[model samples]
Target: MPPSGGSPVEPPSGSEGGVMLSDVMGRDRSINLFAGFLRDIETAFRRLEDSSQNTTVLAPLNSAVEKLPRKPWEDPQDYGALGPNAYEGGEGRERAQQNLRKFVEAHMVPLSPWAEGEKVRPIGGDRELWWEERDGAKLIQPDAIEVVGIAGEVANGQVWIIKGVCHLT
Candidate 1:
């Protein structure tokens, strides 16, 4: 949380800051990996851009992303069913895109200046997320992902650097 009891109002463009999400995240070094991940997923990138200033981006740092068990576009469920050819052809491409989309969506909350206690279902996601302060840290629920800091504030919303990835499925 930026400030305790900060104004929870939603801006018309979903941001009071006069900036774009792409420019903010794309240029920030700490958020580079997450930004590139979104760029690879066309619709997911657009969704975040379209959501600008109005959403919350819980970006994982380079270290956290690099530590993932597999690539963001790779989902175990799909792999189990489709096997090694899961990402081989046109169908594979679509599945990869879908997995990428899910990954990106899980990192975003539909509103900006969100409160700590309110439960929120991320954009294009079914799971609910919420956070609370403990030991001077804002930790998001389920995985207790830590909110490291604010990466950038764009015209659409603020990009929060988080320590862990939330579960998607």
Candidate 2:
């Protein structure tokens, strides 16, 4: 967990040598709300095994969850009350999983080590994302959410911890 009432954690400079995306996300409490998204990313990586295609993950922190619109398939009553695992092993669970996978994929790109100020399209291909650098901090666009940290050297690619959700517009 980050220190209370202080600036967000900054991503380490350069690759830290083969850190899995799951491990990276697990260590950060700020983005714990994105557990569902992280799991979906892991699922995607498993599906694409042995593929050398690197990826850039845009991981949203807890606050971003509040910004996302409720999905039609989601149970409105359980929206914020449920965790990613809550959607497992039940009727419509498969659909929920699929939806989650699509959501995570939409925010990812098949490019690693994405530099600051580079404009690239997400895997979803619905909109473009700009990796803007501001005051030595990296941000992903639509809302200029700062990347608080980064975990590199994962099996598939890298994970970037963004301050908020990247709402598709």
Candidate 3:
């Protein structure tokens, strides 16, 4: 006769009490991608600041620190033609600008990682995301990169986690 207990379950392949590739690639990309996205936002902010003078208040986002090797604006790949919802001409261009603004607003939000204390939450999604603590300091589990630590608040300004590198996403 079969055993009275419930059937045994098999653990996932290549992940036996160890970190999975998904863990390494997934969440890490989110940070990197967001950093890239921030470049455009910063540029837009700079433009606004120039026009508004000192009257406009602009708090710099953490993503501002990221030095993007290449910018999408510089690319002549013709993203407009690539997608079905391409923006062409004056009205289309305006729509595209507005769309970008909305994206920034939704993703670049104020986050207080220090104030909350331990377990930093990701801004991109509802899922709970946090950094593991080690010896009273937060250990940055930056996928395969092995980021030892980072000073200042990791919270704030559109934090997200995605599978694989920014290019893949």
Overlapping backbone residue pairs in candidate 2 total: 0
Q: 15-124 in candidate 1: lDDT tens per residue?
A: 33346675576777887877876776665555555643378889998888889998888878888987977887676776777777788888988888889899999886
Task: State the C-alpha lDDT per candidate.
Answer: 0.75, 0.59, 0.31
**Residue 140, model 2, lDDT:** 77
The residue-by-residue lDDT of candidate 2 on 9-67, one tens digit each, is 33334333444454465566666656545444445544223235667777777777656
- List the pairs of residues colliding in candidate 2: none
lDDT by residue (tens digit), candidate 3, 113-133: 233224332322232323355
Off by over 4 Å in 3: 1-33, 43-86, 114-169
Against the hidden true structure, what lDDT does model 3 obtain? 0.31
The candidate that wins on lDDT is: 1
Candidate 1 vs candidate 2: which has greater TM-score? Answer: 1
Which sequence of candidate numbers ranks them by TM-score, best first? 1, 2, 3
Error of 2 at 100 (Å): 1.4
